[model samples]
Target: MPTPVILEDLQAAFPGWCIWRSSAGRLWATRNGRHLSQHEVDHGLCRTIDADDVAQLAEQLKEQETAEQAL
Candidate 1:
């Protein structure tokens, strides 16, 4: 079997979610929990990344690649 995936691995792979800063120096799940930069979030790096978000991002990347190749 392949190496198992972990949360840190997901976090590293998706640095977009790393932009969030908590008062306690940790990640957050919502805006009230921590102040997230509007820019990063709009830029697709809000740091509120969840598993579903990751999967969606992967799908988007795949679609973008397919479109680029078709171009």
Candidate 2:
């Protein structure tokens, strides 16, 4: 299957803690896609990222559109 989100991306999505691949091989995020792993957060393995982080990521992605437009 195609990998939608990876470990490093998850960490960036939820900064301030470490994030690694779970044996389950699925995204550590929620069904609603709000936060990362809950259990891990409690254990200090990771933390839930704020919505602002996602917005910044979206802005960064605009670079791709700009580049495509130039091309």
Give the TM-score of each candidate. Answer: 0.31, 0.26
Q: Which RMSD values do the candidates have, in order? A: 9.3, 14.1
**How many clashes (backbone atoms < 3 Å, residues ≥3 apart in a chain or on different chains) does model 2 have?**
0
Best by lDDT: 1
lDDT of 2 by residue, 33-66 (tens): 3364555444442232222243343333333234
Q: In model 2, what is the error at residue 66, expressed in angstroms?
A: 0.8
In terms of TM-score, how similar is model 1 to the real structure?
0.31
Give one digit per residue, the lDDT tens place, for model 1 in 1-71.
Answer: 12214445434543433423356644333222546456544545332432234344444433433443454
**Cα lDDT of model 2 overall?**
0.37
Candidate 2: pairs in clash = none
